[model samples]
Target chain A: MTDAPAPGRGWVAVVGLGPGDPRYLTPSAAAILAEAEDLIGYFPYVARVPERPGLVRHASDNRVEVERAAHALALAAAGRRVAVVSGGDPGVFAMAAALFEALEAGDPAWRRLTITVEPGITAMLAAAARVGAPLGGDFCAISLSDNLKPWEVVTARLEAVLRAGLVVALYNPISRARPWQLGAALRLAAEHRGSETPVVLARAVGRDDESVRVLPLAEAADAPADMATLVIIGAESTRLIPREGATPYVYTPRSVEAAR
Target chain B: MTDAPAPGRGWVAVVGLGPGDPRYLTPSAAAILAEAEDLIGYFPYVARVPERPGLVRHASDNRVEVERAAHALALAAAGRRVAVVSGGDPGVFAMAAALFEALEAGDPAWRRLTITVEPGITAMLAAAARVGAPLGGDFCAISLSDNLKPWEVVTARLEAVLRAGLVVALYNPISRARPWQLGAALRLAAEHRGSETPVVLARAVGRDDESVRVLPLAEAADAPADMATLVIIGAESTRLIPREGATPYVYTPRSVEAAR
Candidate 1:
């Protein structure tokens, strides 16, 4: 069935599924997914797409992004419409970069295949939206996993982000293999930020099991920092507004002058 | 019409429209817009929404974010479903911050109103998707406009981003009133990055006049840097791959070890 395609040139699309929520997916991404003949991604993300007769799903284990990317590229080169799916915005710590890496090193013929990336709602953005806007001001996103980068690099960047007084969003803060990284990163952050700094723990944002918790940095050490969680540490000017008989709202103001 | 009785409770949704393209707008944002009785935003953004008898559009000039946010809050407080629209993800340098500011300082009663933020495809994400994924790894986004902050803050952050070797995305790089800011920011970036570093100039992304240009850091200074343009400066690991009969694809590999 895959060999039947001769209607148009084969193409590859690296698409973001947007934090496990169908509502967060962009129209462009949905259209591309509908047209794809082959879908490749991590097992959990690939399971999100409904089974269809014409589409073939290739699910792989985590930590094998490069190999999956190569498979998608090869399929596209053979005149198949292939889609590489990621849970969040593919550009942010996801499959888009891996796809490009494979394309740059693979057969030059793979470079000729039409490729495009369709952006989706990243985890941080979805998490921020769910809990008011903790990332409303100048903020930086850093991944805490040291599988690809050194621990020193992450620490140095954390220090720089803290010194600059920018709101910080930590992705992959902790995993089964690295249980202590989140605590260590928070200690580094606490060194520069005040104890009163607000921290938001948004787990499984936009998903069925989603949960959100807002606390001061002093208490954030006890919050969950699992693979599916996003940690947003507020800047000095961030505020937490408690209301009567309702959950409090957390946000960082717009103007630096106003913040001061 | 303003005095209508409360049907349930008044609410405000600060929504992102996604870099001027309707397709980039998320399904969640679209649903919120459809239910909004009033919409408020900067002129260009408000103009994007279709005209409808039930929807009252309040278009204001630029730099009045605080006032516009206040207006939306007031309408919502008076039993109206108000949608405050922004061009990109509201949490990233957009209306979300302004709305929070207004809510914090406005009437105490305003705090009781239901308010939610709907994330959209931010400009950087859209621009990054256009060219390959230059933001695939650790990255930081900084606004070049110094209207709310000191110029030194922008320069200092640029230096920090460069020193940390993170991919950088510059928003609001230049406007008629700040034509020299983009050049100065690029000069600061060039001091840290090599002349061969790739830069992406994404102008009016997702709009009718959208144009994307990829060039080396040395040549990027000559490209247009208006308010509508987003400048992406690649990290040391970023690579530009040129293909036959196709635009070059630029992406930062996922593995930091490969970057070294």
Candidate 2:
């Protein structure tokens, strides 16, 4: 770095840190972070960024995304190089949308500021990799947390996607406030798919303690899960191959029969 | 460097190179590529890896994924440290599924070999980042190609997802053999949603010549697209903001009304 970013010309980059592993962080995001003078995000996500000289960190609570986003924009509007970092791909149920929601409702000047959204390896992709290619075909990702949307809407979308027979990746499967949503979601899935359908439960993927398990849909409602867990409910074509000494391989074939 | 890898003990790692940018390749994937003795993939993807003295490249034509996968498996079974590389994510309509298809149908002994699938920044994610957080809410991905699946199934899945009002990310939208599919998909989406719905077209994201544009669903069917393009059809809540001298930002709000 030669000279510091000048005042009155700040920009904001909403970047993803990629699940929980530094190794999954894109070099593009890393370079941007290296040049950022300020970082803004939720407390734990902000804590993930290493502290350094001349860089300020703004940590806020989880549900206050709009407030935090407005703060980031106000800083950037004053010409501070800023980055709003998220644990996974910011565009996928992360900070990018929140930032945009704030931007559209905030000052029009914020719209003129340079903004970039950087992609990352989201948790579902990381989870799918640890298992086999369970999402090789058509797929959809739905968040089980009804904090933003009504629970009825969540189930409606879930049932619609399930009936379509697309492989589904469920995020925020279970949290403190919502203990039984995953079970309900699983039961709903089993109604449209076969009982022997493969359900991939992946927790903390890309972390040291990552756990990925594939079970039949019949047995998944009672499976353990947490807020960080990502569940992939496979289509009818999804298959599981039991390995002799390792976890089974689950994959959805690229081809489907004409009869379907 | 350490001694050469011994025969009969070599393993295969299916890894993604991300979407055309070296910076998008995760450190985990880079490390794996660095250790690979043999790289197998489509010609374009295989050519992306820089040639070295000890590294062997096995590039083949497109549509030969299964053949290429079997070749990789045979090579790995002979104790060659092989990497089945795919552009974007290997698990998303890429090599990982093909490799598994071959594994299950190939020799029984191949199941014992250790296999690892490394995730990458897929094209849809990269494309979404280049534009805006069009995928901020629930979303689904569908391939337009009918090579493996029938066109009826493609439309059936497309209509199902569109009826659910989730953001739809269309991959392999158009190609030589399937030049008219993207238009068909846009038309199908228009049937389920308003013609004024936002459609984000991102081409070759993360590449030097990347192009991202936001338009209405009415204009997207005629919009220029190719195999490298990814089209995201927004839901009812998707909003677009026009900037003074830049492309419009498109994003779906995180929340849905209770009435929805």
Candidate 3:
């Protein structure tokens, strides 16, 4: 096992706290956070770490990921342990990439320090668990935000994934500024998926306000969703098993009929 | 915030132990496992859980997922708390689907028992963290094994995902009996991705034997790999950041220039 570098050895660990709940956080993440002298992340995420003496929090506004990452690396280069935190698995559309980008462009000395990226439960996986294993087989995760990539790329990725019959997880489904994007995505999914295909709208997954709904793609278009929502669009084989009292469990079986 | 059922209320929890590392296991998974009266899983996975005084371990051979699920469900129906373990996130190509399939097909009484699926770090995520974030942007995960699905489907998914310029994570990349599939997949990846595009082959991720390598698509085809290895083929935007003494970091830029 790769233990966290000994204290005073200056290392930067990009750790994922998992979706909102403390219980989803890995023991490794907790231990690494405890060892870090400084924690850096988007404001909401860094705030999740409880206050402790000798631990300084550098919470920044959204869209400053590169700056935050560079700051963390610089701290490590100066011989201070730092943890750059993210809400979900840092490698998936999160801080690890930003950290690496920053480290590549920043001071050469930073490369000498140890760096670790600890994986945690990402939203799609947590949301899938709360319901059932809709992502049991092949799947793709796409971020709908056009801030980084062109909006056309998002549309292309969705259509391709849909055509491939892979279950899809849509991250940042709505941009508060552009609510129509979710409707467009839901419509696109309907076109590529079967008429009776299921769609999952999960909001604030793993948190107290967690809500998960499985419905036909048509109805999902009108569902209320914010940036925090993680939307899962099922493949041709996805199914739901109704229960007497609870909402049905939805899962895609492992086996598939070979297409002729 | 769905809490595990009270001790007296029998329940079944399908949990992911996070790619063979104890540190990657979630606190929620650990707690549920601790509360379980019976632990059921494939031989290697069930053995991962220490022998507790009250917990009975039911370790079975592989390919018996359905039977194990039914066994767990039956025990829970009989008022016994049970934990069904998987090596990675149970929702991703693991026990959660089997459990739900069993619950749907088996005795109706299983529906009355409380059931929860606890998310854990899947191999791809853990493997991504081991290197830099090759999955930092849009990505798709496809299982190379045609045991459950048609081999043609695997080819179609790879081509589509590759054409869409999304990073790809290949699970069960090579079966012991069909080793040539890895070479074919690598060749297909080379066809779609740029020759210089980075590809990560991570084996036994998060375990003591963990080995991660990043190379061009052409070289990866001949690299020895097995079902236990998770192969990540980078998107066109994926890049490698050179470090003086360490292996270069690999990551996909969060942004993609619009395709004209």
DockQ for all candidate structures vs. native: 0.67, 0.85, 0.81
The candidate scoring highest on TM-score is 2
Residue pairs in collision within model 3: none
TM-score of each: 0.97, 0.97, 0.95
* i-RMS for every candidate: 2.2, 1.0, 1.0
Per-model lDDT: 0.89, 0.91, 0.89
Write down the TM-score of model 1's second chain.
0.96
Candidate 1 residues lying further than 4 Å off, grouped into runs, are A1-3, A6-8, A257-260, B1-8, B258-260
True contacts kept of 1: 0.78
Q: Model 3's CAPRI class?
A: high
Separate clash counts for every candidate:
0, 1, 0
Ranked by lDDT, top first: 2, 1, 3
lDDT of 2 by residue, B125-186 (tens): 99888877999999999988899999988888888888777999999899988888899889
Which model is ahead, 2 or 3, in terms of TM-score?
A: 2
lDDT of 1 by residue, A1-260 (tens): 54596624789999999998899989999999999999999999999998888889999999999999999998888788999999989999999999999998898888878999999999899999887888877788899999989888888888888888788999999999999999999888899999999999999998999888888999998886689999999999899988877557889986676323
In model 1, what lDDT does residue A255 have?
Answer: 64
Worst 10 residues of 2 chain A by lDDT: A1-10
lDDT of 3 by residue, B1-260 (tens): 23334434788999899999898888899999988889999988999998867788999997889999999998887778999999989998889999998988999777878999999999999888888899999998898888888889899988999999999998888876777888999899898877888999999987888888888987889888877899999988898987676667889889999886
Pairs that collide, model 1? none
Lowest lDDT sum, 10 consecutive residues, model 1 chain A, at A1-10
